[model samples]
Target: MSLYETVREELLRRVRNGTYACDTLLPSVATLSEEFGVSPITVKRALRDLRAAGVLVTIRGKGAYVKKQVRILRQLDMRMHSLHGTDISLISVTREKISDPSMVSLAPPDQMMLCVRKVISSDGAPFLYDASYLSSNVEDEIVDEFGRNFIVDALRKREIRIVKTEIVVEAFPATGKAAEIFDVPNGFPMLRRNYKMVTTDANITIYGVVQAPFDRLACSIDFPTLAMEI
Candidate 1:
């Protein structure tokens, strides 16, 4: 790796591991340069990239420090149709069952269980990795027809409507297993989401974990609240 990238990785590692707690001022450029055996210019470049990515903030007189964590916003809205109202084709599902034996569970016969593993990419780069589970026993036919984009529309076609959803978020260190799938260095920090998708007849709990490079992930949420009376 290039010197700048090495420095960037080190900085991110320290932040994620709590070596440099959030909002804590990092060492001066001179100190980092000496520690990394790189010129101050290279260290500055690395810091610049981190700042641009919203991972770090630089004070005019006090050196740079890590930024506070950003909250991830989850929004659920109706999918729009085209003017012609043509529906998009379902994602092709594969007949092959989940190869990961660790995911299998022995639930009661009445409960439906499904596991989905998807590698999410952005602009051609593999940026996000997700593994989700649904309680509704998806038919083999449905699995064979829709792959990654299978849930929302397939439920509609099956006459099962989702009435509500509950979402929870947390932060955790990436385990070795997760690091392998995410293709990132071990011990990275990631955002974990647990979702309960409720329908008229059943409730399916889905676990969605998003793992990405620290510099590449940004979470934002916007909502309105009622005005308070004086």
Candidate 2:
């Protein structure tokens, strides 16, 4: 490894493993350089790279420090990966006319939809609190299989193909119902995904929100690529 990379890697290791506490100040560049037997300029370059990696921060007058980040954010992908093994506890299921401004596009105003609230947990700890408003055109039997079947899979069983998906991811403090479900303090940082699904026939069939406290899980996405034979 190059000199700067070697320095940055060891510093990264310390920051991650808590040798340097998160949000606490790190050793001065000059001090670290002497300890590592490198010039202060090399150590400064390492610190600069770490800051860009979101692992460290440097206050104007205060020395470098570990950034206090308790969450991991990944890309928001529309594709289904696999069936969830998390225990699904049905919270409530009811038929209601859609009123949410964001959901109105998917859930027709005059037509009623199946509004379902459920919690997904792994090993007894809640990770996702999901609420979905699905077109009542979808059968009742499929709705009944919710806890056991993935929503996308159930839709496929009915020959409904998801042709388009629009998703928005936001990070904010949890409050009220969301905070209660995740069992975290009110105003705790959380990751929320709001998405709408449109079927191949051009019917908007699903409007949903998936929420989880940051400490519970990491997020990621894999997008498909298209290429012509070269």
Q: Judging by TM-score against the true structure, name the best candidate.
A: 2
Predicted candidate 1 versus true structure: per-residue lDDT over 65-115, tens digit per residue: 897764323233434221122233322222333343323332222343465
Write one digit per residue (lDDT tens) for candidate 2, span 126-192: 7788888877776667778764656777777777788888877777777788877865556677777
**Candidate 1 deviant stretches above 4 angstroms:** 1-112, 203-213, 226-230
Worst 10 residues of 1 by lDDT: 80-89
Give the candidate number with the greatest lDDT.
Answer: 2
Quote the positional error of residue 23 for candidate 2 in Å: 19
The collision pairs in model 2 are none
TM-score of every prediction relative to native: 0.49, 0.58
Measured by TM-score, how close is model 1 to the native structure?
A: 0.49
